[model samples]
Target: MPKESSQRGPTADRLHRVVVIVDENSNPFELGCTTEVFGLRRPELGRELYDFRLCSPAPLTSMRDGFFTLTGVAGLEAADSADTLIVPNRPDVEVPRRPAVLDAVRRAHARGARLVGLCSGAFTLAEAGVLDGRRATAHWQWADAFRSRFPAVRLEPDVLFVDDGDILTAAGSSAALDLGLHLVRRDHGAEVANSVSRRLVFAAHRDGGQRQFVERPLPDLPDESLGPVLAWAQERLDAPLTVADLAARAAVSPATLHRRFRAQLGTTPLAWLRGERMALACRLIERGESRMDVVARRSGLGTAANLRLAMRRERGVSPSAYRRRFGPRVA
Candidate 1:
C-alpha cells in the first residue's frame, strides 16, 4: 500500500456506495462485474463493503441487447453521490468524453473517491483527462486504438490491471474482477479478500500477464524470477507449495523471499500462489476448458462445485460462458 498520501483525512466507516454509470451500448458483463465485486454484500467476510446503484446519465437511460432495452435506473446525480464511480464499457459507436460525466469523475476523484474503468471504461477516464501520463490499462484488443486515441495515457496492455494508488484500471472483462479483488485486499486485509475470492471462486490472484495465457503467448525471458516461479507453480499447482518450497528454488531464504516479494510483488508467498492458480483456471476457461472438475484440478482451485460457486460471485460468468468469451486479455 502507498504511504505517501500527505493529505490524510478521517476514514469513513459507512458502506461504500459505488455508483456505476450505465450507458446505452454498455457491456452488461462489465457493469455487472463491477457490482458483483463492490455492490454485493459480503457479511461472512465481516467488512462493510458497498451500496451499488446502477445509474445512467439520464433519468431513464436505455440499454440495448440486440433489440431490447432496460431502464438505466439511477441518474448521473446518483453517480455524483457515489463513493466510487465505475464505467463498465462504453457504447460501440464512439467512446464519449462527456463533460458532465468527466466533471463528476474528476470531482469524485478530487474528493478522494476511487474511479475505475473496465475495458473501454478506460476510454471514459482517458477522455476525462484523469489518465494523463498516469499508468492505465484497457482490453488487449483495443490497446492500439486506445493509444492512438489518447496518447497522454500510458496504456499498459500486458498486466492484468494497473494500480496507480487512487486511480486504478484493468484490461477488459474479467480483469475487472482482478482489480476489484485487489481493492478489497487493499482496503480490508488478506483474510477478507481471500474469503471474498473463495466465495466468488475467482482467481484470488493471477500469475504472468494475460499475454502468456493468451492465444498469442509472449516470450518467457524477463528481468524477473517471479515468472519462472509462477510457471513452475502452475505445473505443480496441485502440490501444496510452502514458502520454503518456493524460496529454495529461488535460491533465497524464506524471510528473504518474503522481503523480496514485498518489495517487488507487493504480496506474500501464499497469496501469489492462489492468484496463479486462479489465473490458470481463467486461462483454461478461455481455452474452452469448461469442466469444473478439470479446471479445478488443473488450476489447483479445487472442485467443480467450488468453481461454480466462486465464478457466480466474483467472475460473474458460468463455467460454460467463461469458455465462450474471455473478459480480460493480456495483449
Candidate 2:
C-alpha cells in the first residue's frame, strides 16, 4: 500500500486518501464503482477505510454521452494528495486526455502513489507515458486499438486486471469493483475487504488473472452456479476437502466440476479452494490469531510450514509480518 501524502493536512491521521480523476466523457459506472467501494463510510466496521474524493480538470465535467453532468468536485491539484490515484475512465479512447490529467498521473507515479486505470482509463495512463513497458489491461473491445496506439505497454488483454505493485489496471467497468475490493484487501486485510464486499453485494475476491470474459457467460444447468458448493466449502474450511468432495457435493463428476468452475469462476476448483483457505488464514491472522498451528489447522492448511509457504507465495509476506501489519495492537 502507498503511504498517504503529506498534503492530507489535519486529516493526516485519517485513512488512506483516494482521489478519482473524473475527466469529460467519463464512464459513470466505473466512477460509481470507486464511490461504492471506497467513498462510503463503513459504520459496520466501526469506521471508514478511506478518505475519498473526486477531482476533475474542470468543475462541471460531462459524463459519457452527456448522460449526466458531474459538478462540485475538487480541481486537478487534489491528485497530488492522493495515495491511490484513479485515472479517468472514458469510452472515447480516440480523444486525447487533458494534459493536466496526464500530468497528474505522472506526478502521482513519480511520488510512489498507487495508480489505477479502469477500463479505457488505461489509455490515459498510456498517453501519460507512465505505463511504458508496464503490464496493463484495458477493455477487451479496445485491445487492438490500445496496442496499436501504445506499443510500449505490455497489454494483457484477456485478464480482468493487472496488479503491478503500485500500478493497477482493470479490463472492464465491472472489473473496476473487483480491483477496488482487491486494493482494500491488500491494505486492510481480508476481513475488512469481505465486510466491504458484503455491503456492495459483490464477491469478496476474484483473482486478478481471471479472464475478463468467460466463454460460457451463463451456466447451462440451473444448479451449476457454484454458489452453494462454494458456501459449503467455506463453512468446512477446517475439513480436508478435495476436488472429488466438491464434485460429489455438486452431484457432478470431477471433469464436469472442472469445466463448471472454469466457466463460472475462470479458475480451477483446487485454485479456488486454496484461495479460500488462504483468505481464511489471513482473516484469522488479522483477528489476532497468534499461534501458527491454530491458524493453519483452522484454515485447513495442515501445518505451520505449509501456512508460511502459502502466505509467502500469495501475499509476498511471511505470516509474522502480516500479523504485525494487521493484527490487533496495544494502545
Candidate 3:
C-alpha cells in the first residue's frame, strides 16, 4: 500500500481526526505522548489540525503503575469514525487482548483509517491481525516475545519506529514521541512539525532506524564517550567530514571509531553524517531558501545534483517539491 500522503493527497487540505484507545493497565506516558501530539490545539496555526479523542472498551480504567484512573472515555465507536487510530503501550504482550478491542481495530483498518501502535501496543495491532506481513516494531525488550507470537510480522527490533503504509509501529516510550512528530510532518508538513517540536522542546525528527538503547559492557566515562566529538561534528556540518576526521578528533583509530559508533549509535560515521546533512538541508528549505545550489552548499551536500539525489533518496521527493510543500509561507 502507498503511504497515506500519496493516498489521501496533501494532509493540510483536510482535517485529521485521531482516536486513541486505552485499556486497564495502559501506560500513561505513551497515552500522554499521543495526546500531546494530536490533542493540543495549535491556535498559532489559526485552525486546529487534529480532532483528538480517547476511547476505551470501558468508560473508566486504571492507568498503568496505578497512579491514576482515566474517566469519561468514549466507547470503541469513537475509533470507527476517526481518520487515525492509536494504541498506547499495553501492560503485557503475553496476555490476550479483549475481543471487542481487537474487532474495533480491525473494523477501523477495514474502513481505511490509519493505525498506530505505540510501544507494546504493537502487540494489540498484531493480535488484531492488522500487522500481518507488514514491517513493524516494538520495545526491544519484547522482541523475542513479539516474534514468537507473530511469525507473520516482519519485526525490526532496532528501529525507533516503522511507518508501514496505513500501519505504524513505534519501538518504545520515547519512540512514541518520534512517531507522533513524524505523523505531524507527514500530514501538515515539516514547518508545522518543527513548530510543534519547538513548543515541546523536542527534536523535530529522529531517524526511525535509530537503534534502541544498547547496553555497553564497558561504558564510556562521562567525558570519554563520543558526545563531545559528535557535538563538534554537528557544529561543522557544512564542512567536509570523513571517518578519518572523526577518528582523529576522538583520538581513536578508524576501526575503534567504527566499533564505538556501532556500540553506541548503531550506525556508521558516514551514514550518521549524511543523516545530519539531510536534516540541515530540510531546515534550510523550511526557512525558505529558494536556490537549490545555495541550499545544497549551506547544507554541505555540495551541489544541486547531489542535493536532488540526497533529497530523493532520503525523503522520496525532489528539492523543489519538498520546498513547495514544507517551506515557510512568503507574504
Best-performing candidate as measured by lDDT: 2
Q: Model 2, 120-191: lDDT tens per residue? A: 989999999988888999999999999999999999999999988778899977799999999888888898
After best superposition, candidate 3 residue 233: deviation in angstroms? 2.3
lDDT of 2: 0.89
Judged by whole-model lDDT over C-alpha atoms, candidate 3 comes out at 0.85
Who wins the TM-score comparison? 2
Q: Comparing 1 and 2 by TM-score, which wins?
A: 2
Q: Rank the candidates by lDDT, best first.
A: 2, 3, 1
Q: Write the per-residue lDDT of candidate 3 for residues 1-331, one digit (tens) a residue.
A: 4255223233656577888999888998899899899899998778786878999888778888678888988887888877888875676678788899999999988878888999999999999988888899999889999999999999999899998878899987789999999888877767788888998899777778888775474645544477889999999988888999999999999998898888777778888899889888988888888999998988889999999999999877899998887788778
When superposed on Cα atoms, how far off is each prediction in RMSD? 14.2, 2.8, 2.7
In model 1, state the lDDT of residue 29: 75
Tens digits of per-residue lDDT, candidate 1, 100-127, equal 7778888777676777788788888887
Q: Candidate 3: where is the Cα deviation over 4 Å?
A: 1-14, 43-49, 216-222
- Order of the predicted models by TM-score, top scorer first: 2, 3, 1
TM-score of 2: 0.93
